[model samples]
Target: MAYRKDNLRTVKQAYTEKRARALGIARARLAELHRTIPELCEIDSALAETGMKLVNAITAGAEGITERVAAIRAENEELQEARAATLRFYGYSADYTDVHYECEDCKDTGYVGTAMCACMKRALSLLSLESAGLAPLARTQRFDTFSLDYYQGDDRLTMQANLEIAKRYAASFTPASESLLFLGKTGLGKTHLSTSIAVEVIDKGYDVVYASAPTLFLSLEAQKFGRDSDIHIEEAEDADLLILDDLGTENPSPLHVNFLYRLVNTRMVSGKATIINTNLTVRELRERYTDRVASRLLGEYLVLGFVGKDVRMQKIGT
Candidate 1:
């Protein structure tokens, strides 16, 4: 359950900016208060020195040290009371000088002690989704939002079973979880289900990478040729889960075929799960990608054949 290094760095930088912004605003407010009320300036200065005074009293180890510490505490409390009274006299809130953080649980630091805070986790999940290219679809293609109303009869029953399998797989996914191969025609919910799985796995804190087959192959080709590529093949191989959508849509080329085999084989060897969504059947897959790639897809991956009318078309018609 980890995020990519770059994504983590992005989130950490955001937290840094947030914390600095809060502190900066608080400092500016305090400066304004000090300028408007001379009495507040003195009170704040005295309050700041109280900490040093206590440190000195403890380190000095002189006689009557307890009495000195007690006196310091009493004086600090009195200063606070005076400060509050003075602020009220000036028609300002007593806490007007406090820094307001976005997430109080970790004070916008993105962590609580040595552990990552919930806010940070959520931030990482969202960033990961965006980086994985699933953010837009994830917003609407989650498991709960999938509709079986577009299916009917045997097709509906088969889709229902497929939906349950996808849900279970996502709920129990791990780095070493079995891979999946979604076979169906265009707009039959293959993309929707695969995206749903990716979203669920991402929300559970695992890094996921989602890319269409054509885009993935193009990026890989660019990288292979020393051109600028947004997505690295290494990221796809290293992700906890990879959702490769619209397979068999890429232009047929020996380079792409070899790259596909290598990518799938590498992830398989590394025990990472991958979900491949293709409109091609097992026979068509073999014909398109050759036996080497198709063998892995059939032998290693759990095949789910979707049966339904084009749900996207149904939606548009209705």
Candidate 2:
């Protein structure tokens, strides 16, 4: 048996449970009606007999097989009408016997023919977000929770405008959209707004990876050195929305520097969506990383500057 990733496995398991529950409910309803309503049972039995007769007529080299099948079909239709009337009399809908699937397009199978259903895709997206370790933070740091009241004067107005732009960006995010750079000091809400955008993108059913710079670059370094060989993940490259949080916090090493350059260049060239949160200015970034990576990031990304007091500190004091 082929192994499935945790997210896909979770989606499959959920769909399986839903399918079983829906089918079980349907079967119980059918049994209840069959026992309580004798007319339904009789009509169903007669319909089954007619179906068998039609099949037999088709199998045998019998003449007027079409007429036999047509007559049987007409009788079956009348029986169906009687069945519907009986259910209605019992204060049940005509489709009470039918399984009420979670997703009508897939009938709870998680697929429409060979294609995956929209509901299944969303389930997988949520599972993927959980697996990315962003689910908990996403719940608390949504755009609705981000407030401009934390800032003052020019900073407050700028933050309000930035909030609108961030909302628009999240609302219409695509892999093809311009990359974003969240630039601000430590006390600012760079991480908050970045994470807010990430939550929205993930809910839109796109793959997203939100990681601190040290964690991200360290994962890359480990992958290079065979230390992280237990599971394969090239998250920054593959994610539809790659949110690299606190870019300046990572310890500098040859491995980290080279990988950062590659990650930035790869995302820029591939037109993949990326958001970088950093306390470092463009000048600082140019001095730290090579000018190529800095130029690409500055030239391509829509820069959003954040300014505010440390809300964490304020909340703590309260």
Candidate 3:
């Protein structure tokens, strides 16, 4: 619901393209019908002229004009019906000349009066599909691909713990939830868990932003330097869920520290849920961000500690 002007433009573009494609398909089918059944074309031509006749009859205002107009309108309806029937005879469904839009109420216009139509919601979902990098993430984790078979009995305890926590976190996700921090070493399935949560939260129809630390920080830096004021901050603050992966990977600077603090602080105050996965330990986090920032995270966040030998190495037989 809280979409940007550009996002609204995306919705409009999607709607326009969908409606145009439907109209194009109907036009093509009509043309095909014209080629196959020439009488259908004649009926369509008569239906087109009926409007002119109705207007002329009303202007002339002769007695019995109402009955005449009604008769002409009825004939026009019958012509449309006959044309549709001819198209059906040729294997197309009824309503051959109609646009076959997703939303009949708005005809893919995206809005009805002041309210958003169903087409707009579909457009937003479609836009998210195009913008979010979901395919690659999904390909990596087949639910069937996960196996306790490889887990090292007691050594496998780490992944087992994380798997349980991650599953519960995903299942219990609500809009009014606290932020999450997944702290662990490399190849500990932190990214996998967080990205999985991203997919789940999106399914629940929440706007979620999933980006690595470097990419997000760079975008924030660009927005800061550019004349456009605080675009990244607004996006971060307003998104229903923020999944910041690889938290310690970005180049640290005073600006970065300040920006992060402000971003975290604002999100915390607003009670927006954020999920941050970091390789930094509690001490390193304190060193990078000040004690206040680190302490607040420790106190407020639901920390899910990731443990285990690097799974990537095991996969590569290292």
Candidate 4:
């Protein structure tokens, strides 16, 4: 599987250390067992001699190799039985000194043959997700954690409806899922619910990219206008759920505007899902961005309006 340099470095380093620790444990166990059991020393020598015999027989293409190999295996099995008995007599399990690896297929080396082990694949995905800066929200912002009690008056019911929509959107999210346009005043539950949906959409095995408008635009601009970057804007734009938080909050620039146009248009053309949370009303959006960009969003996205007193302000005395 393809991996980023940072991801490769981190995952490979961890797997290498795991292999080292596994070998270290096995060696220590064998040494202790060899010291305690005199019979084991003789059995070990005999086993080594039989292994060399098999190697020589194979190298010489010698006749009677099959019979000789069978005899050697028989001898090893007998010796293993004795070894197991010795451990059992000492009140230890048969596998007590056996090295335990997190992945039996790879023996914790992170690969079996030429393919990466499932353990390593899972680790890579999990590590990538964790390092993507969504771990904090994974704990706090979930559909279950969202409270309707935070709203009051008509704002309360509006937020309740918004919350349900967000939940359904998250539950059913896919690469071709309907894109949402979250328009509202600041401090409504827009950011909170959008972030919560992002966490769930990620859990559903989609690459969900979450970033503020400034960070998203500036980084892309830097990659384009300055040093060549390993971080690609395509990764974000092509994500399954691209949540652009706090839109229109970033400083205005032709480069930022152009990048935003490209980002939004590319996703739209590709049928990728995007959720944009902005304080700008529909009228304000048209004025802030170019008419073309505004029309694209207004035409393509499913608009969801959020209305409520600032939840943050309501929480001050509570």
lDDT tens readout by residue for model 4, 196-233: 88766655546767777877776787787875643457
The Cα error of candidate 3 at residue 147, in Å, is: 4.6
Kindly give the number of clashing pairs for every candidate: 0, 0, 0, 0
Off by over 4 Å in 3: 1-9, 42-123, 129-150, 227-231
The TM-scores, one per candidate, come to 0.88, 0.71, 0.70, 0.72
C-alpha lDDT values of all predictions: 0.92, 0.81, 0.75, 0.78
> lDDT by residue for model 3 over 1-318, one digit each (tens)?
434456668678877898899899989978887888888878878978998888887888789888988988898888878877877887877776677888888877778987888667656654553345444674565334555545576647867776777677777777568888999888877788777776666655567776777777787878867845323656667777887889888667877888778888888888788988999999999999878778878888988887767878888994
Best-to-worst TM-score order: 1, 4, 2, 3
lDDT of 2 by residue, 64-166 (tens): 8888778878888998998889889999999999999988999888999888888887777667667666777877788998877788899889999999999
Alpha-carbon error at 72 in model 4, in Å?
17
Off by over 4 Å in 1: 45-82, 88-91
Q: lDDT for model 1, on a 0 to 1 scale? A: 0.92
Error of 4 at 157 (Å): 2.8
Query: Model 1: per-residue lDDT, tens digit, 211-291?
Result: 899999889889988998767788898999998999998766988889899989999999999999999888888998999
Evaluation by lDDT, superior candidate among 1 and 3 = 1
Instruction: Give me the displacement of residue 106 in model 2, in angstroms.
Output: 5.5
* Clashing pairs in model 1, backbone N/Cα/C closer than 3 A: none
Q: Top model by TM-score, which number?
A: 1
